[model samples]
Target: MKHLTLLVPDGQSKLSSIICTYKVFLKANAFWKNIHGSDRFSIQLAGISDEVEFYDGLFSVKPHVNISKIAKTDLIIMSALNNHDYPGSISRNKPITDWIVKQYKDGAAVATMCTGAFLLASSGLLDGKSCSTHWAAEGTFREMFPKVNLQTNLLITDENGIYTNGGAFSFLNLILYLVEKYYDRETAILCAKMFQIEMDRNSQSPFIMFTGQKQHGDEMVLQAQSYIENNLQEKIVMEQLADTFAIGRRNFDRRFIKATGNTPVEYVQRVRIEAAKKAFEATRKTINEVMYDVGYSDVKAFRDVFRKITGMSPIAYRDKYNKESAVA
Candidate 1:
């Protein structure tokens, strides 16, 4: 377990709506501590100023401490800047940016929430690194820092040591990611329950291949896809799936094909291929091991499907990604 520190700018006067971010962080911290009590992860509030001031007319306290002199930490998080939420000139504090650069050199994993990416971009740390911020800030973020690879749709982007998340709801996603990294899925679930929030264990990965296309299509087809993602490694019978939806097998098949342009069995195979690809990234398991885990008992049939959809054998695909990763 490691101690994490959060540094707040001194002249900021008071914390604003961004405190919602810290609240979520504390809740996630408590959950992880409870699960792994002894030698568990911890967070400390370090302010940049000694005299705390409240935002005039707003009920928030000013943070009081400089980024320098903070203790060693495994992770450092920069909260969203309130004014950056709206369209305006971005005046990042130079001192803050300089401190962040120094911390990065000290070997701390850096991350920002929402418009906080603005601060990171100012520091020149996000150069050539893929990052994400609140969807609304995409235009301004790009205009200010064109060198940073900005991805708007993702909840979070984990590029090597730096991790950035979209603001607001994404703060939860970021915390859940931390939980999953240090703790386990069960602990993350309990932490989410503490806040009465639903945690997505698979948010980092694609949920369904046709999520964008299916959002505008038939609801039945969407349900079918959801069922398939949940049961990828299990035996699936089209008849049983249709029965669950209270539709005749023929009608269900027609709707499924119309919405996704793939038959039910075809969709399942596609999912199996995706699973095999992911498995290949982790284990040097043989094609047979990959196929059996993804519900294909017959090795020859799995190889045929792999070649048909991927245009390459399983070994070839694995070797390609492996070599690419190594070169990278």
Candidate 2:
């Protein structure tokens, strides 16, 4: 049997992630027993404390085993941390982080649910590995773990036995993925039907809300970003815009990338696409009408960029998100 350890992390962790993950693994084991006449997962909640409480003790979890007592584990699932307090959680969970590092080196595969990526990333096993987390947490995550590759567009990332998924509720998708990988596709599909979770969801791009990368303290880059966002329908000439800002085009491109993590061209494209996404979500505009309003004149060019960024064609995105448009 595969011994699965669900971590009940300390310091304002999401109670639902721990509860939901525990339930799924237990159900998976039940499904396994029905199919193979034996249990597949030896699941347990392991944490530093005997009981971890959340929301002023409205909810609490009592682990089956403490971290220090477990010597061998086949898998580890970290519950998501509270978005507003992950740094504090990481600092307070120092012992847990250290234990995770030791456990991973001892051959236990680790998976993180949503913002749980922060704790796993803190363990240093993800220092040079690719990771995924909630798209809204991208700014803070990038600032905290610059060495780890943060792929916010992907719904799931699997590298070197480390698995991560994007944002809330999306953790269910990762659980399904792990089930298929270690257990079997038959069990995964069974669980999917039991839970009513859509399967094979591989991208979180359409859900991203880009407000422009403005976390740095570069004043000139800030001004440039504001310009790009304000004039989303314009055909921006980067070199000319650089000249207007009283900097050489090359120096401007260098500084823009350094501050915003995107080149001037990519930044402008994102701003335009962001506007297009909003239109699709909230308005009843046609695909070509919205495309032109966002500054793209070529039908093929606009469709290609839309699909590239959102992982869906314009009509598909609109149909999925806009109720009025879907009916139309």
Candidate 3:
């Protein structure tokens, strides 16, 4: 049997991630037993401590085993951490990081859900490996782990046995992925139906709310960002922006890329696309109208960029996210 260890961390962790992951693994084992006349996994919740609680003591969980006692595991799952207290959560669970690293070194696959990527990344196993996390935490994650490639657009990433999934509740998709990998496609489909989870959701881009990367202290870059955001309806010229900000074009490009993690033009396009997304969500405007409102005059150009950024066309985005559509 495959040994699956769900590493429950200390501090304010997402209770749902732990519980749901355990449930799904149990279901997978049950399915396997019914199919093969044997259990496929021996799953356990392993934690640094015996007990952990969250939500002001409304919920609590006690692990089946202490992490230090686990000599080896076939797979390790890191549950999502509370967004508001991730730093404190990571610090409190530092011991778990070492354990995770040691386990991976001894031939175990590690998977992280949502901001659980933070803990996985903390273990240094994700260095130079692609991973995904909650979209809202992208800036902070980039700042913390510069070496790890953060693929915020992807719903899940699997690299050398390290798996990660993106933002809130998307952990279900990762569980389905694991089910498919370990068991079979048929088993994963059954699990998906049991959980009512949509399978093969590989992109988080459509769900991302691009808030513009503004975490840096570069005053000039901030002003340039504000200018692009305010003038979304108008044509934005990069040279003009650099000249207006009294910075050389080369220096401006370099600083903008460094501060915002996007080139000047790329940043402008992201800002426009974000605005277009909001317009589609809240208004009944035609795709062209939304595109024009965001300063794209060419229809094909707008559609391509929108699809590239959101992983869907404008009409599809509207159909999926527009409030009226949801009501209907």
Candidate 4:
């Protein structure tokens, strides 16, 4: 049987990720027994301590085994944690990180759910590998782990043996993915039906709220960003921005990329896309109206950029998200 260790990290970990994953594996095993009269996975919750609680003591979890006791595991799962206290949470869970690194070096596959990618990235296993995480945490994640490629558009990423999923409750999709890999397609489908989870979801872009990246301390870059945000309807010129900031074009481009993680052109495009997203969500604007409102005059150009950034066309986005359409 494959040994699966569901790791409960120290500090405020998300209880639902731990419990839900454990329950799914249990159900998978039970289903396997019914068909083949054998268990496919031997699962256990392993933690630094025996007990952990969160959400002001409303929830508690006690691990089946201490992490130090498990010298080897076939797979290691890092459960999601509270992102607001992530630094402190990761610091307190240093032992878990060390253990994860050791296990991966020993040939075990590692998977992280939601913000658990933060913990997995900390273990150094995800260096130079693409991973996915909660969209809201994308800015902070990039600033913290610049070496690890953050695929914010993907719902799940499987690099060799390390797996990660996108934000919030979307971890269920990752679980279904793992089910298909370990068992068969029939079993995976059965588990999905049992849990009421939509399977085979591959992108998180449509769900992302593109708030502009503004965490960097570069005053000039911040000023440029503010200018772009305020003048979304106007034609933004990069050379004009450079001249307005009293900086050379090359220096402006370099600093903009370094500070915001996007070139000046890309930043302007994202800002415009965000505006169009809001207009679609809250107003009764036609696709072309929203497109023009965001400064894109060419129909094909606007549609392509909108679909590229959002994984859907403007009409589809409005159909899915527009409050007026929903009421109608």
Candidate 5:
């Protein structure tokens, strides 16, 4: 039987993440017994805390074993930390993080859910590997772990037994993924059916809200972003924008990218796409109309950019999101 440890971190963790994952794996174990007449997994909750409270004391979790007591595990799953103070969260959970590192070094696989990637990245294991996290935390994750490749569009990133999933509550897909890996395809499908979760969902792109990265405090770059947002329909010439700011074109591009995490060109595309997404969600605009409204006149160019960023074509995005469009 594969030994699984669901980590209960020392700090604020999404209580649902730990509870739901535990329940699913337990169901998987029972399903395996029905198929093979034997248990395929052994699951336990391990933590440093005797009991952890959550959501202002609405719930509490007591792990099956203290992390220090469990010397070996076949798999270790870290729950998402809801706290924002990354440095402080990591420092307080040093023992837990160190334990995770030790387990991985001793031939165990590690997986993190949502912002749980923070703890995993801090362990230096994801130093050169790719990871996925909540889209809203993209700036913070990038700034902290420049060595770790953060892919926000992908729902999951699996490399060398280190797994990560994107955003809140999407961790269900990761659990389903793990079930398929450790148990069997049939059992995974059954769990998917039981939980009513859409299976084989590889992209989290459609759910991402592209609020422009604005944390970097560059006044000129901030003004440039506002200009782009205000004039989404206008032809935004990068060089002309720089001239309007009275700064050199080259210097303008440099500051814009450094502050907003996108070049002047890419920023325009994202803002336009974001506007297009909102239009598709809230308005019944036809694909071509929405395209023109977002400043893309050419049909092919708009479709390509929409798919490149959102993982779906214009009509597909509209049909999936807009009730009126779909009904029509």
Candidate 6:
């Protein structure tokens, strides 16, 4: 079993940080447990200070595990500190950066979550390395760390020994990647299943397309959204929807844009594709079964739509998820 050391912050919101850190720990533990029973991995918490209190009325800090031992651990994860109070600067603490750099030089894999990337960038550890953070913090991260390559599209980036994930819920992607690496793809799938979370495994993949944002001139748009949701498994034509909504085709198009931010066809496709994603992740159904359930009649058409929406074939999606489950 590999040892993971989590470096938690001290002060207000520390309780929230601890909660997030524990989630990460539980995810990793569950992932490996699915693979190798109960005795798989271990996590040790090394608090920066004795204990910290949160304004929201929460307190957290695991019992003392010496700071030096943390450095020796195989992996180190830096959780996000208080983003609101920290401002645009990388971090208020310079020694934290130095310690991280030293750990990297010593051959331990270092990682950070959300704005924790700021700490890594400030340490110069991510210099010239492609990294990402939550989209909300893109501008701040870019301006503060010019040397590091900022990649905002990915949920997580694994650069050799360094890994960084966007804040919020992107930590799942990081944990999934770790599961896949140490165990296998099946393990990752099992982890995702346990959490009831689903995401396209590929960063370049497009799991959804919104076509309706063209031009809105009516109430027909929201009606279109409702219609698509109701008829996801049926072949939907634009004229049919317009006639059913009791409006002219051109007029329906204009109203759909106004109500749903997408055109009728766009809305329909989005609904079908979204349903397909759910079916792919939740069921062991075959590709053809999924394709038909999502309303595509021809296997070829289903493949095309699946590829267009997810950047992967339907079979690939099923296989990938299954592989992750097995690995987990």
Tell me how far candidate 2 lies from the true structure as C-alpha RMSD in angstroms: 1.1
Question: lDDT by residue for model 2 over 1-328, one digit each (tens)?
Answer: 7789999887778888888778877888898898799889888899999888888888888999999999989999998887578778888888988988888888989999999999888888888888999989988888889899899999999998899999998999999999999899998998899989899999999888888888899999999998888887888999889998899999999998877777899888878888998999999999989998999999999988888888999889899999997777
- What root-mean-square deviation over C-alphas does model 1 reach? 15.7
Return whichever of 1 and 3 wins on lDDT: 3
lDDT digits (tens) for residues 1-328 of candidate 3 = 8899998898888999999999988898899999899988899999988889878889899999998888989998899998566677779889999998888889999999999988878878889999999999999999989999999999999999999999999999999999999889988999999999999999999989888888899999999999999999998888888999888999999999989889999898898999999998899888889888999999999999999999999888899989896676
* Candidate 1 lDDT over residue span 1-328, tens digit each: 6766565643332253246546756666676666567535566655555543445544545443455667467777776665643323134366666777887888888877767788788889999999888765665677678799987656688987888887555666777676666667776687677766667632322222222225335888888888888887788999999999999999998988756556888888888888898787777777788898889988889988877666568887787766544454
Candidate 4 achieves a global lDDT of 0.90
Write candidate 5's Cα lDDT for 6-96 as tens digits.
9998778899899899989989999999878878878999988998888788889999899989978999999998889889889888899
Task: Estimate the TM-score of every prediction.
Answer: 0.54, 0.97, 0.97, 0.97, 0.96, 0.56
Q: Look at candidate 1 and tell me the lDDT of residue 243.
A: 97
Question: Which runs of model 3 end up more than 4 angstroms from their true locations?
Answer: 323-328
What RMSD does model 5 have?
1.3
**What digit string (tens of lDDT, one per residue) describes model 6 on residues 263-286?**
667667667776787777777777
Candidates' lDDT values, in order?
A: 0.68, 0.89, 0.91, 0.90, 0.91, 0.67
**Tens digits of lDDT, candidate 4, 1-328:** 8899999888887888988999898999899989999999999899988788878878888899999999899998889987577778778888999998998889999999999998888878889999999999988899889999999899999998999999988998899899889888888899999999998999999989877788889999999999999998899989999999899999999999999889999999888998999999999988889899999999999999989999999888998999787677
Predicted structure 5: lDDT: 0.91
Which window of 10 residues has the lowest lDDT sum in candidate 1? 204-213
lDDT of 4 at 289: 92
CA shift of 32, model 3, Å? 0.6
Candidate 2: count the clashes: 0
Report how far off residue 103 is in candidate 3 (Å). 0.9
Question: Lowest-lDDT window of 10 residues in candidate 6?
Answer: 207-216
RMSD of each: 15.7, 1.1, 1.3, 1.2, 1.3, 10.8
